[model samples]
Target: MPDNVLENVGEEYEFEFVDVQSTPVVINSLGSDSADVGLLAYSSLANAIQNEMIPGGQSVIAPLTYDGPRYADTYNSTSGSSITDINGLDGNTLGVNGVGSAIDIAARVVLTRNDIDLDNVEFREVSFGAMPSTLSEGRVDVGTFIQPFFEMNSDDLQTVFDTTDAFGSFLKIFVTARDDFIDENDDAIRAFLGDLWTGIEWWKDDDNSETRLDIAEEVVELPRDLLEALVQTDRGYYHGEDGLAIDPEWLQKPIDGMAEVGFLDEEIDMSEYVDNSYLPEEANTEPTIE
Candidate 1:
């Protein structure tokens, strides 16, 4: 997940989802350029906040520490490795969606953890839609993209490194909406959470394995094999319970690190940036379906 996604709806709730993409016109039809709530890759939303696209978005729960393949996502979600760690990334180029973009920052942040200087790592800004393709062509050393890009094309590409490597679970896929949305349509937001949780619940049920795979392939549009791998028992996606559960330690570490690296302003308080009351009392708290 890219950074912009914010949570904190409630400690009671857990996890995050990638906001389904629709045509720009469809997004515009929401009646306001300001989406009361929008699910985004954690980094995307994080970048949005940095640019003031939305105010006060915080990650509620980080279900899975996010990871991007080192190369194009043609195949191999868990196959090849990227840079094999930051030390390998000491002096190299990173391809990103754009200049000074979230992907660039995420890559830099991961590298910075190894005491790598941003000035030393060259950045190549390409269009978001074209990044994966660009990486596959060997035009760039590394690229940061969410699921479909890496999932669909990891056939030959590799994941050099992720936020989790240097920062310890710093990666996260998240759900976020503008602060106004949280203040205004509490019910709508709640409903959104319910449906989202239901969707994930259905996705993890063993008896419903067929259905789950179907949705992942058709609904979520995930690569068939990768979707299956994610649904396997005791691995991928679901944790003790809430697939969306935010690891407090994981969440805060990145926040603290980002600020330490000058990615965020110290003036911003985490509380004002997020809220967690919206989560229901019993999230998928147990790994067992019981």
Candidate 2:
């Protein structure tokens, strides 16, 4: 999305994409002023603030994606495995990219709801790329998958459950910056958000579907047909009528869930951390596309 935004409004502002491995690193970068803006899972915000990872802490400025019934992270086992559902996960190993990551927290919430003791369920930190193989090899009874990984390997996996089953439709990933940086670059941030909303609007239009898939094909390393399937399903991204507006209620679900599962020290009020003021007025208006 940032790349698309740059293409449409490059003359107005400059952006450099830095590849970071995880949300913690993104938070560290923002806290140190090394990065003006970073993408992070909504579940990590409270912990970052509580740990004092950022000097003045971070503020979420825009939502990047949402996860729910149609699209969400999933816990899966090999297609013919004995672990047919969440009930089969008891006293078994679960794989996640990180122990306290958004994926892990979501899984914890689901397990807790099923009356499964977290102490009995082992959480193995398996990278996303390794999850499919890990499950197939019996190294982990279930592994969490996101995006193209899930779509790419669906034929061999059976989903035990989806995160949405626990938290409902919730804000997944979001854009954040240090509170001080937001204060310093108010107008520039607003302009950037406006352009970002423009990019989002362009992408959400059904007319641009082919072009969007063509662009994804270049970067995603997936078959053309698979890419088309993702595009057909809105690529599992949230494109609401409010454009780039961040709904505090959408974010609060995960925040409260994270705390319930002990991923966060306590629930952080999302309204306090979300600053929709940076979004332009047009963002609140309904999208022009159907």
Candidate 3:
């Protein structure tokens, strides 16, 4: 998508894409002025706010995606485990990418929604790459796993619940910038949003699926079949249909949920962490795409 956008807007602007593995690191990098813009899960944004990494006036400005249930499943090893569902997770150890990560917030929300007590469940820090091994070794009874790990270890795991089942469709991630950056580079930021929105629209079009898969294969070096399967399963990708504009009201679910699960001290004003003035008024109406 970046390549496609650059092909059209290269003369106007250029962006460097860096892969910061986790949300905490992403927020830290943003706080230290390492990057002008960063994408983080909505809950992670809340975490950053509570941690004071994002000050009073700085905030995210655009929506990156709305996630579905294709990935991010709670699983238990198939070895005589009694944890068949969220309710059965009591007294079980759940492995997560981090203690206060997006998955942790989701798990807590899901468990609480079902009246499942969280005190009995232990959340262990396990890396994404190490999840399959952790589950396979019986180190953790329940683990929150996302693709392609979920897909790879389905045979050895039992499905407990999916994130969507806990919380319905919600705003997933957003593009954020510090207050000073947003103030000093308004025009550049708008242009970047315009270009990014156009790229998102291009990628969402069914006609470009093959081209997108080809690009994904080349960039990530994953097997073409896996890439094909991702697009087919409605894997959690960015939503370009919304012109990338953010909705503060929708974000309250994750933020409130985070507090409900004790990840945050209390519910925060979602508006403080979001500014949608730079986005197009209408979804899919980016001028660059036109």
Reference-based lDDT, residue 118, model 3: 84
Best by the TM-score measure: 2
**Best by lDDT, which number?**
2
Better of 2 and 3 by TM-score: 2
TM-score for each model: 0.66, 0.92, 0.86
**TM-score computed on alpha carbons, candidate 3:** 0.86
Score candidate 2 by lDDT.
0.81
Model 1 lDDT tens row, 191-287: 5565556555555557878865775688766567777655544335333334444444444555555566676665234444444455554563422
lDDT of 2 by residue, 1-290 (tens): 55543443465566788788988888878878889899988756767876888897778888776786357889999999899889898989999999888888888898899999999999999999988888888999999999888988999999999888788888788889888887887777887887777877777678988888888888876798988878648556555535666768778888898889876766678888888788878885422221
The parts of candidate 3 lying over 4 Å away from their true place are 1-4, 7-9, 69-81, 238-243, 281-290
Taking the tens digit of each residue's C-alpha lDDT, what string does model 3 give over 1-290?
55544443565566787678876778887888887788888767887777788553457777765655334445555546777878778788889888777777888888888887888888899988898888778898887777767666667778887666655656777778888888887877777777766776677778888898888888878788777877544554535464555556667777788887777787798977677788745552421111
Candidate with the larger lDDT of 2 and 3: 2
Point out the higher-scoring one by TM-score: 1 or 2.
Answer: 2
